[model samples]
Target chain A: AAGVIQSPRHLIKEKRETATLKCYPIPRHDTVYWYQQGPGQDPQFLISFYEKMQSDKGSIPDRFSAQQFSDYHSELNMSSLELGDSALYFCASSPMGTRADTQYFGPGTRLTVL
Target chain B: DQQVKQNSPSLSVQEGRISILNCDYTNSMFDYFLWYKKYPAEGPTFLISISSIKDKNEDGRFTVFLNKSAKHLSLHIVPSQPGDSAVYFCAAVTSYGKLTFGQGTILTVHP
Candidate 1:
């Protein structure tokens, strides 16, 4: 089965710079979720979308924004990046209806802010 | 405030023994609970889940028990093997598919 796909498995950026991460959810999956895992910490919910529409929000920072495209893929854009933003960014997907709560995660994108 | 908590940071068990990991949650609104197993440098893999209406769920060698009244859940791995060594996380969901995760517990199964 095809799993969620994330771009730039590893990313390096400098302070005050901008970065964009992309995610391609599993085929037919209509819900996309973003999470961040800091060093020595568990994954934290950032945001989520359903069928290209904003569905729920979490602890995402003001400097970060995300949107799901018509193709069911999503992008997370971070501006004025800070060193503290360095962490493993994960994208997960799930089908709607009965299996909506069952999310399958991608490998994750490791962001390193220098 | 932290909604989910896994008090034990680590657990060591001999191979072929049963491994039990516990989790507690403060939010009563959470209606669904799941257990995820994660290896280093990898994303969390869903192991098993239990609905609020169900007291337990089992899959192969893994089982999840829910104590709704106590707001607690636990995962049991029978006859644990060395390959089962990994970090286990407990997650809860209320609505909108947002998962609140607990601090993971590292399980070390020694052969």
Candidate 2:
């Protein structure tokens, strides 16, 4: 079975609207990371959550935020979406506090902001 | 600025031939390096990795060599198969769990 799972394989939102994306980490894993992939580019780290806390955040705009619940499921929220926000979002997970290496990814969610 | 870089935008290889993908990084603090393979509409899949402590790591047909002093790493796929055709991304792990990725190289294997 695939390790990580992301919801809403595709999403479309209007400019200034809020978009919520969800992700479920692999069972028993404690670290979850989010990344954004723009067209013809490599994936960019967005944020990481471990032990129900924000472990690290990338140089993303303040309009983007993430939350991890007790169950290890995480949610990425984008407020006031812009056309530039159109991209593929990936969720990955690894074992707790383990070296930030060997992360398993899920099929991403393609977001199109109009 | 792109901390990690994969200069080659694309490469084509004949089936059963060796495919070498190179990556360089400007960050000296990156202790772990990894390569990922991705197909269209899919997230990147972990391929191989090498820690800063080790110069090389191999698994089956894939091998990753890391040179800490030069801040360079390369992935070699022996006897590449058609199924191996995908976009390969090189990444480096720094201070936190954040990973810096390179603009991927698309590899096409012709049978």
Candidate 3:
């Protein structure tokens, strides 16, 4: 019954400002993923973390960065946000290192960059 | 280069009828597939999954069929209900757990 958890359920920021989103993976889950969902679009992979290290980054801009702490909590930071950055950010977690593992998603953080 | 593709943007079906949502993938390396359902403002929830080794997987009213040869997969919801209305996404895993998702298909089951 473990599920992913994200904070700051909704955020509004001006362009050129900074935004940070947090995610806590289920206990014992080893992989954490970040995705961005545009309005009426499917989720797009942003980045992933495994074993407290960045495993992979999707085709995201350099302004976006992510970190995973010792407790498997991950933070995605966007510096100098743009209006295009406005989207629902989702955090997901899966067991171990396999890609076939089922991922559990958190109620996403809706970011609106004005 | 969209590896996963959901050609249909939306589908409508009467309640108690069968609803079929289709997805196609261009990546032959994909070994696992999954379907997810999402409401208006919530994150997607897992609905069903199938491995490349299997042709079909079923649970309750939902069934997923995978055709490895054609690089296609489909989700069938039997006796669809109003509550079954949501956006459905098809995802493929080529590497371990990282997924490539297709544009979702919005399904509306009318009463």
Top-TM-score candidate index: 1
Clashes of each: 0, 0, 3
lDDT of 3 by residue, B1-111 (tens): 889999999999999999999999998888999999998778889999999999999999999999898999999999899999999999998777778899999999999
Encode model 3's per-residue lDDT on A18-91: one tens digit a residue. 99999999999878999998876778999998998988889778999999999999999999999999999999
Report the number of the highest-DockQ candidate. 2
Q: Which prediction has the highest lDDT against the true structure?
A: 1
Tell me how each candidate scores on DockQ against the true complex.
0.71, 0.79, 0.73
Docking quality level of the chain pair in candidate 3? medium
Give one digit per residue, the lDDT tens place, for model 2 in A1-114. Answer: 657899999999999999999999999998899999989888998988889999888867899989999999999999999999999999999987576565888999999999
Tens digit of lDDT per residue, candidate 1, span B5-63?
99999999999999999999999999999999999878899999999999999999999
| lDDT (10s digit) by residue, model 2, range B17-53 | 9999999999898888889999999888888888899
**Inter-residue clash pairs, candidate 2:** none
Positional deviation of residue A2's Cα in model 1 after best superposition, in angstroms: 0.8
Question: Which residue pairs of candidate 3 clash?
Answer: A98-B97, A99-B96, A99-B97
Where's the lowest-lDDT run of ten residues in candidate 3 chain A?
A94-103
TM-score of 3: 0.96
> What stretches of model 2 exceed 4 Å from their correct place?
none
